[model samples]
Each structure stands twice: as structure tokens, then as C-alpha cells.
Target: MCGIVGLYLKKPELEDQLGQLFSPMLIGMSERGPDSAGIALYGDPVADGRLKLTLQHPDMDYDWDGVKKALETQSGAAVSVDACDNHRTFDVQGDEETLSQWAEANLPGVTIMSLGQRIVILKEMGTPQEIVDRFDLTNVKGGHAVGHTRMATESAVTTAGSHPFSTGQDLCLVHNGSLSNHNRLREVIERRSSIRFQTENDTEVAAGYLTWKLREGMDLDSALEAALEDLDGFYTFAIGTADGFAALRDPIACKPAVLAETDDWVAMASEFRSLAHLPGVENAKVWEPEPAKIYTWGRAA
Candidate 1:
């Protein structure tokens, strides 16, 4: 089992409190998943023609300053660094290909969590509260965010096995429950799509599947609908994208999921307690998400 929480702010006024509001929800679900935890936050977009790269080094004392200078020199792009614990986010002004080449040649032993315009994902092998504290998550400000606490069922308890796996640009997923046919599906995906997965976790495969579909021009809603048919499992997923937040449940609906929405925000979690502290939640429209259905909210919608 795992714990998943997501908050999508409809009111621009609450953007500044995105992390403040999300922190407790993640902590509330600590008992559900104590193995590892992570969060995907959608902050303001970087300047056009530039991309953001979120990286983490296992070494706590890694020299970020030297690495930053090296990246700037290698990519020939201005880079700004934001450090949190062992994690650093670099806003790099260059094309994706150039940055990829530079990273391959220069930044060995670093894990690239996510690369995109509006999303930053930070996760590690630690308790939910530890992750929150390590990243100063309580002070983070964003438009929307998705978080997860994982009790490992299939993979080893390591930073790489953590939840909120990212496959597409600005897209990530946090999942509860297991995918029974994941291994087979992983083979199928590897044979057909250009996408490559870096983890053995089923959640990562699910994220990659969605990335493949999105690359094929399917929108989030359609990609989820396809997932219901193609994937076999009892799972609840909270997916975050550059401009949208979505939740999906398998047809069995065996996993727990509750959604609460008000004029100001839309929130979902594995249980009601995770969302108990949101402002105006007492008056929110709360319900259990239907099985095999996709629920979505976006800035554009």
C-alpha cells in the first residue's frame, strides 16, 4: 500500500500556500507508507527557450558550486541553482539536446529527477516528514502539487524506488496499490516505444506508458482511458502535468481514494484525513472518485 495526495488550486490567491497546505496532507498519510516519500510541485514556468532540471546527489556534501560552474561551461548556458538538502534544481538556458549531451558527459553519479518548464520533483528514501523537512517544502510556493509516501511492495527501499515517478516533461504520477501485469507491460512498452524506464517499480512503468501515449498525441484524459483498458491492476493514481491535475482508479476500485473540491481548490488523497486541513474544505464538494473513471482539473479548463 501507498499514500497519495494532490492539491490543485483554482484560486490564484492560494498559490503562495501550495506547499504549506500540502505538507500536512502528506504527513497525515505517513502511517500508510513509511518506506519512502516524494512530491511533484508545479511552480511558475521558466523563461521560454529555457528548461529546468531537478537533480539529486546521494552524497550530502557534493560540491554544488563546482558542479554548477561545470554545467554552465559545458552547456554554454546561464544556470541558476537552488539547493535543498542534497537536491538542486537548475534552470538552464539551452535546448534540450545540448543539456542532455552536457549532462551525459559532465554530471556522472547525479540523478535527474525531472526536466521541464513548470515542474520540480524531489524524493528520496526517507519518511514523509523527513522529505518535507529536507526540502523546506513547507515554504515552497506553486500552482499545484502531488505527493506520495510509499511502502515498498515490489522494489527495494531506495531513493530510486520511491514514488512520484516522472517520464514525460512536466508529468509525474503517485500511485497506491500494485499492477499485477506490470512486467509484461513493461516488455511490451520497451519493444514498442522509444521511452526507457530507469526503475523496476510498477509505478514508473505506468508513468512511462502515459508518456508514450502522450508522445503519440493522446491527451491526459484519453491516455488514462487507455490505461484502464490496457493495464490490469487495482490502483489509484494522482497525476500531475504542466497545466493539469488528474486522478484515476482501476475498474476494480480496490484502492482507497477520496476527492474534495471547492470553488477555491480541488484535492484528493488516499483518505479524508489527508485533506482535512485545507481552507474551506468543510464546504467543499467531497466524494469518492468512481472506478475506471478519470477526474481532471486544469488551468486551461
Candidate 2:
């Protein structure tokens, strides 16, 4: 009921083409999901002691420069703002938590998409091509990226309800299929973890679950291993982080998933057609990810 695509470049020379390649893959899946689309890009890290925050505003005339000045004055550090469409990426030289607090008090009607050292997530209620064109995704450069086009089976079509949910810093998840026990799991997570749920969407719960488990000292692979046991329902998840990307499927593996890996990159999609046009794809190793197995790769791993 959704489309998922992820790309991790193994060749450093292809880093600059990350977005250029990924944009088409995402667009290819538009028929699967036309309600909403999103992408999480893991680009170069911000300068040490700095972080990036992506904020979206509904108002076209929003004053980005004024907001940046206010943030800089309040945080007592330099803040740079880059505007693209309705979203603004702020490179802030201060504590992420402190800046979030300042925004909550000062910026009215602004939605914070993500804050991290290496990731920027942009998603909205539109077709995949529309969303990408609005954000100039083809020009974006990153080490790795994951994207989703949603059909809206679980939640209403709203910007906040879009996929690629981010519950932890630099972490995002795009899911296909529904979770059968999400309500129960959501209740359990809320009672047991400090991480709070921001939306009723089950995908957000999945992202929160990963964040909670990682905070509990579980490595990414181990956390995904645990997810297969605790979480129910059919799903194909493509998760992104600061350094890498990972994919997981339910034990039953009802949802579709295809992976193509070449010496230069690793790519995954809900279907193989999305990957057919990638460079060296014909020579790449192709297969369906096994049930209950986790596939992960990145610069760090």
C-alpha cells in the first residue's frame, strides 16, 4: 500500500549523485502511492558542535531571515537558514534541545521535521514527483537516503501523517503495509519509554520503538532483531540514520521488497522496477530480502 526506496553509495565518487539517482527511483513508485511522499537524506555532517534542523511552514511569506536572527540571538550562536519551497534547513550552532525549546516559544505554526548532524527529512501531502520538485531533491547530495510514497491506508492525508517519521535524532522510517498490534504496542511503549508519540500514525510508533530500543543500548541490528519478535503485522521497513540505512520485514514477509547491490551502491525498493534505471543495476546482485532477516549498510558499517 506504499512505495519504499533506499540507496546507499559504496563509492565515494558517487556521493554527489545520491539525490540525482534517488529522485527517479522515488518517482518511479508514484503509482503505488500518490497520497503523500517523503525522503530522508543523510548528507555530510555539520561542523562539529553544530546540528541541522528542518522546519516547514504553511505560509508562503514566512520570514526565514527573521527566524534565523531570532534563533541566533536566543541561542547565542550563529544560525544559517537555507530555504527551499516551504521548508527551511537551519544549521544551528547550539544544543538541539535548547533550540527546539526556543522555537516552540517563538515560532508559531512551524513544524519541525527533523534535527540531526547528518540528516534532513522533507515530506508533504503530494505526489512523489511534486514533493521532490518542490524541494529540488535532484540537486541534493548525500551519503545515503530513504524515501516513501504513501497510499494513506492507516492515517489521514496530512503533512504530519506522512511517512519517514523521525522520532530520534537523524533517524527516520518508511513503512509499507499495516501493523496489526500497533495500538497495543504504542500503549506499551508510551508507558515504558520517555520517548513520546507525536502522531497517531503507526509508522511513527515504529520509529519510536527503534529509538527506545537504541536508547536501551541495543545496537541497530539487535533492535531490528527484537522488532521481529515484539511487533506484529506485515511490514517492509526502510530505516535511515546518521551513518547508514537498514531494512526489515515481518516474519511472514507479506509485503514486497527487492534489493540490488553493486560494488558502487546498495539499493532497495518495494518493487524492482523502481531500481531498473539505476547505474550498473543490470550487473548488480538482485534478490528479495528474506523473511525475519535484517539488511544494513553504510559508511560506518
Candidate 3:
């Protein structure tokens, strides 16, 4: 069992409270998933020509300044760093592929968590409250966020095995069930695209699949529709994108998920209790997401 929660704010005024509101929703699911916790926040887009790369290292006081200087000198990219706990968000005014390659070859202990104009992912092996406190999640401001708490039935409880896996820019997924065909799917994806799997976790495979589909020219909703036909397993998924949030359930719909919407926001969680404390939730329209249906909310919608 796992806990997944997402909140998408419809009003820009609420962006400042994103972290304060989202933290509790994540913590409420601690009983369902006490192994590890993660969250992907979307907002604060960099300039049109720039990208934000969030990187994680095991050391709380990693040598981020040295890394930044090396990156700027070698890659010729103007980089600004925002260090937070064990993670750092680099605003890069350069090529994403080149920067990623440089990091892979030079940064020995660093892991790229997420790369995009609007997404910053933070996760680690701990209770949801611990992660929140470590990252000071209550002070984070964003337009939307998706989080997960894992029970570790299939993989080790390492930070790399945590949910909210990012396989594409500004795209991440948190899952509530297992995929039976993940190994086969992983092989197919690796052989077909430039994307590579970073971990053995099935949720990573699912995220990679969606990334591949998006690269194939399908929009988010269509890609999710295709997922219903392609991905086999009993699962519930909450997908985070640069501009939107989405939820899906497999045909069996065995895993629990609830979606609630108010005039100002849209939220999804593995259980209603995760949504119980959100602002104005008492009057929000609430229901269980239907089996195999794609439900989406976003800035454009």
C-alpha cells in the first residue's frame, strides 16, 4: 500500500500557501506509507530560454559551490544555485542535454531529481513529516504539487526507489500499485528511446512510458488514454506536468483513490482523509475517480 496526494490551485493567490496546504495532506497518509516520502512541486518557471535542474546528494552539506563553479566553467552555462538541505536547484541558462551529460560524467555522487522550467522534486527515505521538515516544505510556494508515501512492498526503501519519479522535463508520476509487465516494458522503452531507467522501480517505468508517449507527439490526455490500453496492472496514478495535474485508475480499480474539486482548486489522494483538511474541502465536490477514466485539471482548462 502507498499514499498519493496532489493539489492544483486554480487561484494564483493561493500559490503562496501551496506548501503549507500540501504538507499535511502528505503527512496524513503516513500510516498507509511510512517507508519513504516524496513530492514534486510545479511553479516558478525560469526564463523562456532557461531550465531548472534539481539535484540530490547524500551529504547534507555537499560541496555545491565547487560543483557550480565547475559546471559553469566547463559547460559555459550561467548557473545560479539554490541549496536546500541535501538538494540543490540549479537555474541553467544553457543546453539541458549538455548539462545532464556533464553532471553524469563529473558529478560523482549527485543524482538529478528533476529537470524542467517549472518543476522541483524533493524526496528521501523517511516518514513524510521528516522529509517535510528536512526540506522546509511548509515554506515552499508553487502552483501545484504531487506527493507520495511508500510502503516498500516491491523494492528497497532507498531514496532512489521512492515515488514521484521523473523521466521527462516537468513530468513526474506517483503510483499506488505494481506493474506486472514493467520489466518487459522497460526493455522496450530503452531500446526505442534515448530515455534510460535510473532505478528498478516499476513506477519509474510508468513515468518513462509517459515520457516516451509525450515525445511521440501525444498530448497528456491522449497519452493517458493510450496508457489504459498499454499499461497492464491494477494501479492508481497521479501525474504532474508543467501546467496540469491528472489522475488515472486501471480497469480493475482495486487501489483506492479519491478526487475532490472546489471553485479554487483540484486535489486527489489515495484516501479522502488526505483531502479532509484542505481549505474549503467541506464544500468541495468529492467522488472516487472512475475506473480507467482520465481526469485532468490545469491552468489552461
Point to the candidate with the largest lDDT: 3
lDDT (Cα, tens digit) per residue for candidate 3, span 1-301: 9999999999999999999999999999999999999999997899987889889999877889998888688757688988888999998866677767778888887998988899999999999999899999999999999999999876788999998998566889999998988999999999999888878888888999998998899888888888898888868999998887889999999999999999999999999999999989999999999999888889422
Global lDDT of model 2: 0.87
lDDT of 1 at 261: 92
Candidate rank order under lDDT = 3, 1, 2
Q: How many pairs of residues collide in each model?
A: 0, 0, 0
Residue 142 CA displacement from its true place in model 3, Å: 0.9
Enumerate residue pairs that collide in model 3: none
Local error of candidate 1 at residue 127 (angstroms): 1.6
Q: After superposition, how far is residue 278 of candidate 2 from its true place, in Å?
A: 0.6
lDDT of 3 at 154: 69
**Residue 281 lDDT in candidate 1:** 89
**Cα-based lDDT for every prediction:** 0.88, 0.87, 0.89
User: For residues 1-301, what per-residue lDDT tens digits would candidate 1 score against the true structure?
Assistant: 8999999988788889998999999999999999899999999999998888888889998988888898788768778988878889998887655665577567788877888898899998888898888888999998999999999998889898897888656889899999989999999999998677778888888988998898889878888889998888879999998887889999889999999999988899999999999988889999999998888888421
Error of 2 at 109 (Å): 1.9
| Native-to-model Cα distance after best TM-score fit, residue 289 in candidate 3, in Å | 0.7
Q: How does each model score on TM-score?
A: 0.95, 0.95, 0.97
List candidate 2 segments past 4 Å from native.
none
Over 50-95, each residue of candidate 2 has an lDDT whose tens digit, in order, gives 9898898888898888988887887688888778888899998876
